[model samples]
Target: MNATSGAPVNAPAELHDRPIGDLIRDARNLSAAEVEKVLSYQREHGVRFGEAAITLGLASPDDVLNALAQQFHYPLANAERRLASPELVTLLQPFSVQAEAIRAVRSQVTMRLGQGEAARQALAVISPASGDGKTYFAANLAVSLAQLGGRTLIIDADLRGPRQHEVFKVSNSAGLSTLLSGRAENQLIQTVEGVSGLFVLPCGPIPPNPLELIERPAFALLIRELSTKFDHVVIDTAAASLGADACVVAARCGAALVLTRKNENKISALQDLVASLAGSSAQLLGAVVNEF
Candidate 1:
């Protein structure tokens, strides 16, 4: 699905409309004889087919969940296939409290981003320091935004210590840094597997002059181009203290969300960063405090 347009997702055939029994059978590779047993047990116990399958150990919980996800059009990763962190609450447990909170943040951000202007393309996720859950929050926010249906692109601009490639389980052999450095010509952005309408521009290989690259006029051109191509853009940046990278990124995007973590971030640093943003061209959308 192109999040930039109203196009429908490139979803698989409508399997969710099928009966749970059929979904369960296909999901678990159950034979006709095994399906009969599940049906028999379901009737005998007055339980759903999925429940009966689970009770009989014919299908694991993950199997049931996989079938259910198909039935609901919910984007879910197969437990056997996911390589990202469990803390990716938005994708792993979309209904969990954490995911819900991310959705809430998305709502707030979306409400603010409604516009007919080009600045609507990207939202910079920034912080005063590292290890403040900026990448975590940025990754989840991108996923949550993608869940809204259209395409959402999260650009890993953290050239100093990039990690969105790992968070989204994508190859970082050629990405943002490489593209900015004039080396990448193809596969600059990869469509995330399993998550529809989500794309990633990984930080690519670490560059020698990260700030110099971001400061180049090409960076501004890139932001403008990306804004036009994607429905929503989320750019993750190095901490403000690392340099003016975050500030520059936020300025280019025209909006930013500042993040802080409990016990790790110095209040004075956050105050300084916020103050700095207040004086910049970018609008300070809001601040989020991440605990644990």
Candidate 2:
């Protein structure tokens, strides 16, 4: 119900705004009579307006959660209906502990990323091996960054074992690999259906020579080109143990975040991975231990 903070006359606020009751009223299109009933029930039952609305079957539990999320200026997509991958906790459970932890990581990454004279164009999420939760972290982190109201894009650069397209529920028939290989696809970049300010460039078909494709200058050129079109570009890369794809991708992006699974990732391997990334020009934006 609130207008944009310094917006001009006749300008409306973004759908994203404050207050649970007002947001619910607007979102559910409640009538005046419905609002009065909800308020009276809320007062009589000593419950919140959203609770009253849900109790009266005027609004669903998902509606109440969405209103609450709007009040706190956070983003939430229905867990039951968002996508096939429930691992994107930032969208599916924005208030959960896992989501909060990922947001904390986002905050740190953003702050560190903006400190330099020349801000980095993109960030590559890399891990030493598969099953290290690299794809999961990249997908969730992209959602969190998009929640900051910036146009954020997550590129599925892991041509070997790409999962971002599946995670975001976008078609991977033609994406980064196809685009880099000079092949034509109907749609290369896709706007994620539910989450605002988020986009995905899937890995397309799995190339037999993923390393060779990534090693080509076209891949770096594509990252640079995409950087100009997006506010924040998050790249999901292949595992370092698989090849040098992650390192090369990170070097091209100018920044990298190292991810490791708890108990499964060896300390020595992680240290060596850090050293390898450090040797490159890419700024090491610190490492994340993926416990989830």
Candidate 3:
């Protein structure tokens, strides 16, 4: 419930101040009698209404969460009943604590990417090594940006090891690789259903030469074209310490953020990756220490 602090200012005043129980009742997820049971349990156990509802088996956890989301005017995950995981919390559970943190990152990214005469419209999310959580951060950040009512696009440019298509639940049959290979048309982009102003471009099939594809001038053109069409373009790239693909993508995008998992990534490798990005003509937008 503390996550309500990040609610959009344009949200209704009542939504901002409504009690959790009232919101749950308005959502109609529980009958009046069930709500009364929850309230009685909450009063006796000093637990939140959502928790009480779940504890008493009146509603599943996902149901309670969806009710809370409806109460707070946050976007729910999918119409298919799939719950959002902690990794993609921003899309499904926009009023969660994790989503709030992602919104904070979005705020910093917006200001940094929008600065200067020629704004840096594209951002490549990179990490020093694999398992550093760059893709997770990039996906959630894109969702957060889209929640602001601006057109936002997230591209899975990490050719060899793609995840955006899976995360966004879109097809990866044709995307960046196919687009760059001239095998796919502009149809490579897919709208994230249930999420307004949010789109995804998956990595498609893994190419034999990811570096060659990324280094081509066509890659820059693709980024430029995407930038013009979307208010924000967030690209997820490979680990810099693993290969030169991320650096190449970051160089083309012109703005990059390094993601590192606490107590997992090597400091020396991070230093070397940052130095490499600096040499690649990519502006470093500060590093993020993700606890995930």
Report, for all candidates in order, the number of backbone clashes: 2, 0, 0
Q: Mind giving the per-residue lDDT tens digits that candidate 3 earns over 1-292?
A: 0011266878676653677677666665668788888999999999988888778877667666766665555566854624534467876566778788888988888787675534546999989888888888998898888877768899999988999887877888888899889898657788877666789989999999999999999999989888877778899998886689998998898888889899998899888888886656788988899886
Give Cα-based local distance difference scores for all models. Answer: 0.86, 0.85, 0.81
Scored against the true structure, residue 143 in model 2 reaches a CA lDDT of 91
lDDT of 1 by residue, 8-120 (tens): 68865577788878888887789999999999998898999999999999998877887887787778876643555665788787778888889999999988777677436
What TM-score against the true fold does each predicted structure earn? 0.88, 0.86, 0.76
What C-alpha lDDT does candidate 3 achieve relative to the native structure? 0.81
| Model 2 alpha-carbon drift over 4 Å, by segment | 1-34, 43-48, 54-61, 70-73, 115-117
Q: Alpha-carbon error at 259 in model 2, in Å? A: 0.5
Could you give me the TM-score of model 3 versus the true structure?
0.76
Off by over 4 Å in 3: 1-73, 78-81, 84-86, 115-120
Shift in Å, residue 221, candidate 2:
1.5
Which stretches in model 1 have alpha-carbon errors above 4 Å? 1-12, 43-46, 115-119
C-alpha displacement of 103 in model 3, angstroms?
A: 1.3
**RMSD of candidates 1 onward, in order:** 3.5, 4.5, 6.8
